[model samples]
Target: MKKILSFFSYVFHPMFISVYAVLLYFFLTDRYHSYQELFLIMIQIIILTILIPISMFYFLMTLGKANSLMLSEITQRKIPLAINAFLLYILITQSIREEVIPELYFFFFGALASTIITFLLIFVNLKASIHMIGISSITIFIIGFSLHTQVNHIYLVATFLLLTGIVATSRLSMKAHDGKELIAGFLVGVLPQIGLLSFWL
Candidate 1:
């Protein structure tokens, strides 16, 4: 369940949304697209997409450390504002053309949700949580498919939220996170993503 949730979250995060949205736009305009065109585009995104976010995620993590979002600034409210910059990068770039997934908004929510799950797990043991989230993501996806909830990303998002709750609770029960630190972690993960949902703007 955890793994499936993570997969859908990763697959549908904001960055991925840009890629998928572009693909959708292309299909709407082209009206007669082919499978080969689709494959080539996804290949382009999959390879290059990882490069940008890896660096950005690291930078944010380091900033998180320095700001004490991890172990330092619990009271100061200095949660490494770099995540905002990362989201800005996603909003702008994830939708680049030659796009395979083409429907960028879908990609946006997927990547955004996935990223959220990743950040939350950071407070715990990332290696273990990631494996759980990823596997759970796929399982839930199948369940969602079976249930016929494809129009909205609701199934995956719901799974993501529930699993995140579990992980957060686990951390709390383990005494790995104090109240302030837990809030900081959530702020670090969520605030910036909420900031980047430019559709409202």
Candidate 2:
């Protein structure tokens, strides 16, 4: 359960999910859904998803733990933002290839917007809480819907209100987040999802 939860969490991550969405779109519309192609792409997606975040997190950890002036406490804000932006930029650029349709642009844009929103919410609160969790769902719905091509826009949108509530209860039990911070984090998670959905649907 722990591993499953972690995997799900990572899968929903804006950066990772963006990659999945791109790959899904590529395979879905290519008119070439051979098992061979899907297998190849699935490997590519898994590799990129695991590799990118692991690399970035390692760099961040090294810098932060090195106790270097580069990761100085005073400059923590600058570093996280800079690192996040760079990671986001690289991820989106790689995911939305030139060969793909322009609608892919909406997906990337959703990523950007979500990153911005999440950072802002994080600044507002350090901990995740029920409200933050709920906001994330709402955000996811909005982003998904924004894409304008989502197969089940309504279902995705509804997940916000429904899943958010359940997640909120779970968080409460785990004591992972306080109310205010949780709400903020939820919004942060959700806003990008909404942006992404809008890009598609």
Candidate 3:
């Protein structure tokens, strides 16, 4: 049971959530461009959000700057979160400037905003669960997408809800966070995206 929970935590690590959400959004939405263009976008997001950050985390670990890949320590989160805020700022600005998937810019922006808020919250000595933040962010994005398109993605919504529960359970089972931290993480992850929903509509 412990191993299974750990596997899910690793597979759905916070670092990979944004890319996964972007990938799903691209595939699920219409594409007027060629397959190559779509592939290129996916590659860009994967590298920017996943590959680079993962490599950076590993390097930070090697340098004793980060305690673990999980970022279980509050102090360890500062540099990585700061780097993520910077990178996400660049990616979203570039995407908007290029007018590529302009409609989806809010999702990326919401993620960036959430990261910034999370980074700032570290100063107050709060260590909310990043796992919950990642899952909830994606969940809110999917919900927003459904509302924007006037389509019922009930299944997708339900799937993420289940995933949210799983993530919360795993975090608790690992003794990484208390219920209060979990709730705060979910709110911090979701509220930014919800606030940006009006721009999309």
Candidate 4:
């Protein structure tokens, strides 16, 4: 039902996608050799991409800058997207500077690229579906990771792709986006990751 669809949409929110992507990368690559390391990395990523953003959203809502947690209005999206893009950039740069998780540099860069494009498109009067963008970014990153590692992750890739469809449907069912916005979101999420993967690979 509509409630179920709304639940799914909330469950797979774009704000959490960045953290999910990095966690997926770590597990897929078997880079989490120890609990301590994994804990540290997860804490860092969650704080940067998830916790801070949540707090900011609450703050924005208090200030009347954002009308909803969803930021469903086009005008409400610009500042939040800009802030997220900036935070993502900082996350990527700091990871590089610290020489931590070098394998994921391109992945984070792709995420940053996606965020940048999404923010820019807001200026063009396009309110692309961030939901679609979030899912697409991870799906594309998984594909690129499989290729770079010369490992077959077709099942995982397919699973993420399937999730993409579910996410798209959820967004549509919730009346969060039209077809054009959905398509734009998917492309914005995918293309940058592909471009970055090619350069890094």
Candidate 5:
């Protein structure tokens, strides 16, 4: 049981959420994007969102500024979140332009807003569940994508809803977050996505 819970935590870690969102966006959209274009976009996402963050994490770990990938401490979250926000800003402004792919563009925009909010909460010594934030943000984005594209992605939505509960439980079991932090993370994750729906959806 412990191993399984830990597995979900790592599998749904915040660092990989952007890649998941982009993959899902491509999966569900009927729009035609060339294989080369999709491959390049994916490569960009992997480099910026995953590879860069992992490298930064190792650097911070070497400096004794971060101990783990989970970033279990509020103090540890500051730098990573700030870097993530900057990366997301670059992704939206330079790579995924709104005119090119409005859905993904707005998705990153919402993610940036959520990252900034989470970063701000750290000053007050509040540690919301970043796991919850990641899962919830992607879940709501999936929901919004379904509505906007008029695709019957009910099964996908249901799967993520289930994953959301599993992730919340996983965090609780790991003692990484209390109920309030999880709820706060959920709100922080969803509100921006919901608010930005008008621009794309």
Candidate 6:
């Protein structure tokens, strides 16, 4: 049971949320973007959100700044969160343009907003579960995307809802966060996506 819960944590780590969201967006949309274009976008997202962050995490670990990939410590979160926000800013402004992919653009925009809020919350000594934030954000994005595209993705949404519960349970079982932190993270993750729905949804 412990090993299974731990697997969920790694599988749904916050670092991979953007890629998952992007892939799901492509899957659900009937957009006319070519395979080549979609491939390029995926490469860009992987490089920025995954590759760079992983490299930085290693460097931070070597420097004794970050102890784990989970960034379980509040102080360890600052630099990574800042880097994430900057990268997300770059992604939205330069790569995922609203003119081209409005839905994805707003999805990432909402992601950026959530990242900033989570980072700000650090100052107040609050450590909301990044796991919860990541899972919930993508879950809400999936919901919003379904509505915007008018696709009946009820099963997909239900699957994510189940995954959200699994993630929450995993975090709690691992002693990574309390219920309050999970709730806080869930709210932070969903609110921005919900708020940004008017623009593209």
1-201: candidate 2 lDDT, tens digit per residue: 545443433334434554555455554453445676556655655555456555655676776642421222322434454555565566457754535544555555544565555455455445333233334544453444444443455554565466555555554454444566556666665565554553345
Model 4: per-residue lDDT, tens digit, 145-187? Answer: 7887788999999999989999899999988899999999999
| Backbone clash count for every predicted candidate, in the order shown | 45, 40, 0, 0, 0, 0
What TM-score quantifies how close candidate 6 is to the native fold?
0.98
Model 2 stretches with alpha carbons more than 4 Å out: 1-16, 19-49, 62-81, 97-99, 102-104, 120-162, 192-201
How well does candidate 2 score on lDDT at residue 104? 51
Across 30-134, the per-residue lDDT of candidate 5 in tens digits comes to 899888988999999999999999999999999999999889878999999999999999999999999999999998899899999999999888898889989
**Candidate 1 per-residue lDDT over residues 44-128, each given as its tens digit:** 5554454465555566567554432222232221232235335534553654322433233333443446545555445564312
Between candidates 1 and 6, which one is better according to lDDT?
6
Assess every candidate by TM-score.
Answer: 0.35, 0.55, 0.93, 0.92, 0.98, 0.98
> Which prediction has more favorable lDDT, 4 or 5?
5
Regions more than 4 Å wrong, model 6: none
lDDT of 4: 0.82
After superposition of all CA atoms, the RMSD between model 3 and the true structure is 1.6
lDDT of each: 0.43, 0.50, 0.83, 0.82, 0.93, 0.92
Q: To one decimal, what is the Cα RMSD in angstroms of model 5 from the true structure?
A: 0.8
Pairs of colliding residues, candidate 3 = none
Candidate 2 versus truth, CA RMSD in Å, comes to 6.2
Q: Write out the backbone clash pairs for model 5.
A: none
Of 3 and 6, the candidate ranking higher by lDDT: 6
Candidate 3 residue-wise lDDT, 25-131, digit = tens: 77667546677876777787887888888899999989999877888888899999998888888888874332667556888888888888888889998888889
Model 1 clash count equals 45
